[model samples]
Target: MLKQYKESSQQTYAYGLVDHLNWLDANRLTVASVRADHLRLYMNALTGQGAGVYGVAWRERPPLSNSAAANVATVVKAFYLTSNQADPSVVAWFSRDSSIPQHRRRAVTQNPLSPRRGSARPRFLPDEIVTALFEPGVLTSARDVMVVTWLVDSGIRVGGLCGLRFPDLHLVRDHPCGQRKDPHVHIVGRDDNPNRARAKAYHSWRTSPDGYVNDGVIRAVSEAMIGSFYAYLLDEYHPNQHLVDHEQVLIHTKGHSAGAALTTGGVRKMLRRASQRADLNSYITPHAFRHRAAANLYAASDFNADLVAQEFGWSRAEQVTELYGRSANRHTMKYLTEAWDSIPGRPTGRD
Candidate 1:
């Protein structure tokens, strides 16, 4: 049942199911005996306004945010579906489409998943934050600097960055794939990695890391990023004799785990500490770098949504234009207003 998802996603689904199981145990109900009413009670308890105890061990935990609730519902549904397929003896007890009688065909209001559309507004870091990240001493480690440079320049997800192998990088202008005017990195998903870092939904090249049978995508990197990467590899990474056999791009250089592969959470924590040291927003997330890169690419491409989408590996231009083009949109709106006001006989506010 867990084989369909990436390791990280499988872990997430496990946690969500654990939460549901905890609720069942606390309510003295068994999964085999559950029905729509029990599901409603469970959802109500998750929301924390219901009559029963919220969670078995979540007494101190607050109600889940809307997106989180929706995700939990999704995982729960998957669990039931997988279970049904695995063992049909268990009754088809809960369903997303199943409805409660009182709510006008709406699936039991309490059992229904929270609306998924109200996800938090996407945020992109300003240009100044990028400058701050690269400032001298802001990131003391070459590895940190290189990581930031790659994220901003390549716009790969943090997991993809963590999963990166040395051989996947074509930092030079030439490669077996073809000659390129610019350097680029190949992003692929691997299920066997110790760090569990992977590109979401990218499994085509899972078995062939450096082969032509890759379903992976290549993203161009700036010369500056390439320089930083080499500096990190030659100076920081290669010097670690312990990591001579390792293939991962970013490795630990401090503490007992020096030269070991870095996990995605460890990278986020490293960035947080660096941001704190630099007097920047400590809440600055890795994804914010991706957003900033997408926005910058959009603006630099003259608000060409397709160009931005291609650069960011988004299948749809709408994803780039609508979600990640805030900075470019600001520029676009300003230019439109300026052109309108400059027209001959255009009405002015004072007119």
Candidate 2:
């Protein structure tokens, strides 16, 4: 589970599961023969062991998020299914009907934080905020401005942007990366090891290619941004090489030297610094730009979630529609004006 999720969070979960499995075996059920209902009971035992979150049925443990719980479920279920030491007695307890009935489970009041913790989605940036972020010297680094621009325009996640390669970009309209009448870029969801994952699909169960999502004005913007990043990489580090030996695009800047792909923590730090420079506050983050960009297109393009989702390489359009697509603000105002213009004015109505 830790290796698969790759979130620093799963470590605690791995630890908890290991500890509890030993406890479970001491009482009755062996680890391999654990069933869903038995698992629920085991979860309750953890509550007795101070796993519950501040006097509730939930665990107060650090990594006990709803998503983490879900991941734990997946991990444990996989563990039981794979272990081959279960006899019929073990299998009986592990039967499909082993889910704990509602009556037998922990009966307690729910805390909003306990289950179904939401995804970390930042709000969409307002136009004023973006314009503010780019004020002269607000971003001392030339690279910072470009990062926000690309993030907003391209709707690419911070991780995905950091993982991009130099060869993947095609900036000019006539270049191979360009889409006939549009600006385009080729990007993929590469794993920890970027070299071998080239041309592979991101989620193995899904069919979408890793090198998907190219062609749009955002594509051109991304290409331009990547080009700028390349310039920095060359000027600051390898001035003679055409191919960047490093796999990641955005590298850390240590005083005067070039570093590795701007890490997630570093990205946050950059935003914080920029925010301090501008001396204005609310919230500013990478995903904010992505959200705003999605809103921009959604507001302008007849509420097109499908198009936005595909271009952004989202597995579903629900988030785009529910979160991004709306009928108000600057974009809606312009749309409304155009709609009014299309209809003849000076109408007579019964007063």
Candidate 3:
């Protein structure tokens, strides 16, 4: 799950969790035995670094947004809770540990970084702007909508989206394709030789990290989109003549011929072009859609934070407080206008 989300090295987040877990095991601290203070300490450690040391991997790109850092913290916390479910003694230990400590953050004042500046930020389009972003054959054009929709609806990172396969999508309702809870649209990421022993459903290429589901999201992904994706696969993606079967979802164009699959870089390029057409400011990119969706859901929801988080496969809602922060309070004027004016032929100013 972590590997699938595009950002600074997503794998780093997963690996970091592993590193933290190993430390806990080495110290004889059970997962439920972990507490908020410990998680806070990890967060503080991450924040203390000069931007140079924070995560050199994302050179040229901006530091992970504060929201992203918090999310990573939440995932780490979940790692303990989920791993500790069998032991009640550990659970008691964590509750008494208390909340994260308040600390003044230091500025990341480093200049010697590696790679390109463009990589620093993963770009995305805002939802409203997306309607006008595509241009038939060009980037953000008609060809772009399916893949773009994949990012918006699935919220899967570029890598995961790139790792999808045709068999993964659920063409019919109720009956899951391949038995995975992941929507019928096949996730592209897969392990080199994953332990299929316990991996029946959730056919994501990357190993499973967390298990959170939002039924509303499942409901929002229309069957029409799935059908369109199917048409795309059959009409566009072709594995190859030599390969009897291949395991990838979104494929690349074969210079007028179909090829294996779209590369991660290719996905990024498409996103960039789409954002440009949408007339979004420089900051908006393909990834902005996920942020937008999470943000939109937070605003539109009836203060149902947990419900909103569940749809995005998020395990914790507390950290998303910022996303759901203002909510619909100020936006209530729209509702009021509709509510009173449409009261079954009620008198209007014009009348």
> Among these predicted structures, which one has the highest TM-score?
1
Ranking by lDDT: 1, 2, 3
**lDDT at residue 68 of model 2 (Cα atoms):** 49
**Across residues 1-351, which tens digit of lDDT does each residue of candidate 3 receive?**
464544334554676566556656655665555554454444544544353332122223344555455555555644544563525543444333343333422232111111112212223234456565544543532235677766666555555456544444455655422244434543332444111111112322422233322121122355546755756655555334333235555555555435545666676787666666556666344456666565567676766778776665555786346443333244577999999998996889893
The TM-scores, one per candidate, come to: 0.78, 0.58, 0.50
Error of 3 at 54 (Å): 15
Ten contiguous residues minimizing lDDT sum, candidate 2: 108-117
Best-matching candidate per lDDT? 1
Q: Residue 116's C-alpha lDDT in candidate 2?
A: 40
Q: What is the C-alpha RMSD of each candidate to the true structure, in Å?
A: 5.6, 9.2, 12.5
TM-score winner between 1 and 3, please give it. 1
- lDDT string, candidate 2, 1-351, tens digits: 356554433554586567556656566656655544556655444434335312123334544445445545555554554467644444444443446576754553222112344654445566777778889988766567667767767766676566566555555567543343444556655555332222222533212245434432233355656565566655543642333447565665554334545665577688888888878675477767667777777766677788777766667898676656642244567787677667877454537
The local distance difference test score of each candidate is 0.72, 0.56, 0.49
